[model samples]
Target: MKNVLHYKGYSAKPEYSAEDQVFYGKILGIDDLVDFYTENAKELEQEFHAAVDDYLAFCQEVGKQPQKEFSGTFNVRISPELHRKAFRKAQEDGIALNKVVENALTEYLSPAWHENRTVILPEEMAKMYSAEEQTVDTAPDDASHLALWKRNWTVVNGRTEMKKRC
Candidate 1:
């Protein structure tokens, strides 16, 4: 389920307040603080849309520019080891660290990546075919396929890890 509402190029993150028995949200990526509240769940989205419209109207009345939703720049925190690894990879690829991060994010968010990819967990593979049952015919000898499988799946400490891409 989506927690954010979108309207007319503006987005708001609405959250439920159990104490107040209402839903409240604020305009996202705006210079000024704009908030809205509603007690009815059905009206929550309407309230968000109204708040966004009002914010835009107020901006126009004041001759101010409304902030865009995304600026394509943000800060992220990572462990030093990961940071070093990413930096090293970027250097090896003759690209900037930002490009590396952007490419990773794009691949992760791309629907084609999810649709074209097939992941077989170690446990699932074990259930489907035992090690003893694996024959030369069952496993291809192509190096390219082996490389692709290596790139797609990794087993660390006997636990298979699957990357989220959707």
Candidate 2:
């Protein structure tokens, strides 16, 4: 079985070696190599944390900055045609190509990015709701409909009206 341990925001994946009769794990993402081993899960957990602490301490002693998992920028290889199309779409939308790429990547990686995370409002903001409540028309269930899309025209106050193109 594959075992994973998390400590101090770092994740370690453990693999068992039948010949060695021990479970060994290494921290996954950062460039630094950290390894721990144990026969038991509880001991493995302690070792995992200890390995992380040791890594941090070693970096501190050496005066080397800890490596972060991601730098928020990376090179992506795509066909030249697709690259040109993306740039053209960004130009037509009047937005930076970087923003278009970022948004598309975020949406693809996180399916629930557009969904609300919390079901109920926070208790600290209850006073705002206690005031005279004003209701606004909610968007469509499947939000891909044009009602949510701002076009040359929009439905305002239950009537279709022409709007200034933005």
On the 0 to 100 scale, the lDDT of residue 42 in model 1 is 94
Model 1 lDDT per residue over 1-166, tens place? 6677898877888888999999999988777899999999999998988888888888899998888556789998978998999999899999999999999899879877545344445675545543432222222255564433323233443344444322
User: How well does candidate 2 score on lDDT at residue 153?
Assistant: 34
lDDT of candidate 2 vs native?
0.70
lDDT of 2 by residue, 1-166 (tens): 3266787778988888999999899987888778999988568888888999999899899998766657688888878998999999999999998898899888858957444332344455443444344332444444665465333433333333333322
List where candidate 2 sits over 4 angstroms from the true fold.
1-4, 18-21, 69-71, 79-85, 105-166
Model 2: how far is 154 from its true place, Å? 30
Write down the TM-score for model 1: 0.66
Candidate 1, poorest ten consecutive residues by summed lDDT: 131-140
RMSD of each: 10.3, 13.8
